[model samples]
Target: MAKTYHHPKHDIHEDAGSMRADTKSRTTKFTSRHMAVYQAAAAFAKPPSRAWRLVWSAVLSIVTIASATVAFADALAVPEYVGSARCADCHKDAYETWNKSHHALAWTAPTAGHVLGDFNQSSFTHKGVTTRFFREGEEFIIETDGPDRELTKYPVAGVAGVAPLQQYLLETEPGRLQSFDVVWDVEERRWYHLYPEQELRGGDAFHWTGPYKNWNGRCAECHATGFEKNYSPVNRTYASSQAEIGVGCESCHGPGEAHIAWADPALSYDAEDWRGLSSVGLTMDFGKNTEADIQQCATCHARREPFLDGNPLPGAPFHDSYRLSTLRPGMYHADGQILEEVYVYGSFLQSKMYAEGVGCINCHEAHSADLKADGNGVCTQCHSSAGNPEFPSLRLAEYDSPAHHFHPAGSSGAQCKSCHMIERTYMGIDGRRDHSFRVPRPDLSVSLRTPNACSDCHSDRSPAWAADAVAQWYPDGRHTQFHFAQVLSPARLNPDNARDDLVDLAIYDGLPGIVRASAIDLLSEIGDPEIAERTSALLTDPDPLVRAAAVRLQRGAQGSVAIQNLLPLLDDPSQSVRIAAAREFLNIRAVRLPSSVSQKLDRARNEWQQSLVAKSDFPEAHIVIAGIALATRQFEAAVAAFEEVVTLDPQHIDAWTMIARIHAALGNRETAIRVLDDAIKANPQDISLSLLRTDMLP
Candidate 1:
């Protein structure tokens, strides 16, 4: 990615522009080279650590297992940010509109203007702990339970978001900032716990002071501009930095320094007749760029794990920087509806609008971040009596009329959002609308037990009542096509018998790449070599997600079997896919890939290692790092990495148990007992920790 951002507000137009060149082909040509698969097979002759052995068995359950940065590291110059202040000089109105938005206030140093919470010694209690909020001179103070469960006063160092709820951040430890759980309700003008239902306290991973709530690791990337998580693995501290306090002009519009340089009257010239400065000196041309605006927004909006540790280059392709979460069983309904706070990108992927090349800016105003129009007017902008020219495939009809929606005008049921974009509340008070734009499927809700808009509004009515009412309204299952949910639900529930069906779904062309990739990921649990062999064809798939998913399933096979199937993928064009194949290949000590494929493996393996190094702050990242160390017989390094995992997350049962196991294997019985005793103290309820110590005794 170029150092500059490039979404020019005046330049972007909603048209049928060409998509990214990379998306054009699913396959990249790698020369067909027959290489002998032989290297130091003894490299992994030693049995893997207990945690390492779980790679094939339990990697899918770990969110960050397949995380990788784009292979194109340092390939492009990172643009210099001249700040949003420079942008405001050229475009005052746009800057003003953006400044007033939630994006601009996404993250900020505590100030009277930015701080919305009551600081006049306001108090709120949850789970028998009372937290008092007050001001101490210029600093905001949070008097609450600390990490050690002792009453401590933490000075608020930062603030996140400005409306509905505001979260304050405190530098609880040296170089470590954590978002406080006690949030202030902007409307109600009182304090309330975001996780009011949960009995979270000190030491719980989800607690405000725990790793999950770390501001630098979890929140800063999206909340701030040009953020970098400079986490030092050696000292285990953060030196995190950001260009601006909040999501600003440079975030979407690239860097302003180059754009200002391009504005030079002496340098500005047209290149149509071979004149100078044809490129306009921007990171990318937004005039014909359809996906940049949307994909750029997805950099922050999506529920995804980074390919890199923190933020990858903002203007690059979405897959190059991040691996999007699919419609996983817990995160989404079987029918690809939003079930969790997955943000927008994953839900939008399932929409017909996205398939039809609809951009986020189409419905949303670019600067203000408001809908293009209020309520039904926003939907009418495209779904009017005359359909939008950009999408001729869309039906030309009165979609907002009672004749279509089967509800009276000015009613909640009549609203477009109520049906297609049914909302679910998250963070207790934050209600987010769905982005899938799906037609209400009360019928699926009846069978799959998925929530439908009708049943959501009519609380007293069951899905059967909603389905029956739908039958009366439009008899022939109006606009109801065969949904993938019927197949996916069964596949998720019982994978043993659903292998063939899942294999079919993985290759289903009509469905989105995300859905197909999800089907392929599920094949890992089937434990059938035949099923694994079936998904091998998808290794050459155009969709990187599908190909990566296919590569992951090959982990069950060993030696040349895994090698022959995975060698070419090490040179795959997609960074995420290449890294996935490389990670699996690196783990297979059964056979050594010959020097012929070493170059490809080296490049891919380096990229994979870089991802691990980048996300060293995350406990899951350490799991893979530690596994690799154990595989290579670096016992001390393995111990260090496993220790890092528990240090970040004390309740990690696998890491704690593995630590004791490795120590015992090395004949350090006394050292191992001390470790087990500590583990038992941290996780008293987990019997596995206690059993490890009991089994070790003579």
Candidate 2:
């Protein structure tokens, strides 16, 4: 799969748990956790002899999640996670197809064939720092700047990814793996830096050795199957484990224990009819269900904030556990084409293909996870003169022909993906295609400064030239139609002035949920007085994104009005929407509601809290927890949570400041001053901290 790691920033998704694959979730707010982790760990040790070996060849250990769960739901017994190797016994063909694919090799212990990078005293220098990659017996050793800014040798504990680039995993301490940022370009066979332009040092969030790079918090959920990030926030330690160290059959096909027993009756011959089990003993039938299958792939493929931590099983509802990021500024072009590493889900959500029920497996093979065919062949599977019978909504057309592309046959321009799903190189050599699959809109590009596929090939030409060429090719096209970018681009810059325009866009029919949701998000930022009344219609919008965004717009309303507006949504079918509505009611105290509505609110509130706690490793979650505690008059609990934030992230200035203020509010002047002093000591380089301490001193 195409991958990229964007520079970490202060990303606080209203409700998200883990980063998934996109380091976009590994935010600057997590900078302090590096200090905390480094302080806790001792001297680095050489990696053991091939300890990180991939586990799919055999099951290592069994974790019966349904051990206690079976009693309550006997008929629907959740299966034990039998590893991928077990599935091979019966499904030989499927196992063989996947055994050598990228998914199978997504993560592994650095064995002979697994370690691709040259470890024979290779040195790579970036930002005036020379890092050496060398072999220490059977271990891959990297000599680089440690958290204390001294050159230290750390052994590679594991390897992540297998393709354009591979990142080394270092166990900074027991049970804590940090994803070293110095990546190996697999294709080029060279080492490169992710942040080539800047000099990153100790405590920097984007630094290779920072908490943002911690494997337990970030990568394990996507790279491993049945992964559990057993993070202990109190002691600041981890006991992370996974069923398999790579994306296995169980990762996508769901736990195969029941499937295995169903296939081989001897395994559970004396038990109840296993065939009668839901999905014929499999967790889900990905081969048959389009939506569930796509969602299963999206578990690792999408760039979104997670709602719950730990890897949810395959076929779990995507919305129930994730809050998909919209086409937010800086991450996406104004017209909703990919700009950053959003992976696939957000982009796919914008495509008409997704609306038409086109799923991951439609063009890509199920086992290998690669395209069924190359380039135009993939698109031609449906776009040919004879349309695919599976999708009757598609019009019969010869899209692969040169006449349609206006380019000579066999040229890059003539390829179907060349014009629609253009590629953007990220994480050095990793080139990711925009899954949104939008048409070239150089006309919008000319007006909005967004990238267009025409510009991608014709690098020297102006947008106007490309627009004219497109106009000549198809005069009656969407190229000239009014696009949402016309309003959204300017709204991003000046939401205040674009209030009316945003309200209009949010209410507009036939737009993608993200576009409308983004409009509502911008409107909320503008503090539009009439926001609650203006976007009222969107509460019932078919898209959960719209409903959730609409629920957020009711944040500031109080009394019976707030309850009336957000109370109904507490029971929303979408877990994401219910969580959104639950948060809106968190600070609304002393408001009486219908008995049913009150019950829903209580349930939704718990749901929201559990989702936040699921990502307890993230400091942002603690900040949210503190806010909740403060709202409910649990000042001591709020302070304790804020202190937990400091423990995880000592560089979090706002958290330290909040801690001081809370103490001051309780009339503990001496304690407040002491807290400020501690904050100053923790962050001596920050002038703002010095000033805060000075202001607090009598």
Please give each candidate's TM-score.
0.85, 0.85
| lDDT, residue 564, model 2 | 79
Q: State candidate 2's TM-score.
A: 0.85
Per-residue lDDT for 1-698 in model 1, tens only?
00110110100110000001121111110000000000111122243344333321222211122221212322223346778888887689999999899999888889887888889988888889988889989988999998989889999899998888898999888879998888888999888877778887688776788877888887788887777787765456888877887888877766555566667676553333221112654443453567767788887777776655455444557766666777777678988888777888888878889889998989888888999888899988889888889888888889889998889999999999998898998877889999999888899987888888998899998888888888888887742667788888988888767888888899787888888988876676655677667777888988887887787677666557778898888777678787778767654664555766866776666555555556667776666666676655666666767787788788878788778888889998888999999999988889988888898887
Per-residue lDDT of candidate 2, residues 331-377 (tens digit): 88888998878888878888999888999999988888889998788
For model 2, the superposed segments whose C-alpha errors exceed 4 Å read: 1-11, 14-76, 269-277, 526-529, 556-558, 593-596, 633-640, 656-698
Which pairs clash (backbone N, Cα, C closer than 3 Å) in model 2? 9-28, 17-306, 32-649, 52-109
Number of backbone collisions per candidate: 8, 4
Residue 99, model 1: Cα distance from true site in angstroms: 1.0
Relative to the unseen true structure, what is the C-alpha lDDT of residue 388 in candidate 1, on a scale of 0 to 100?
86
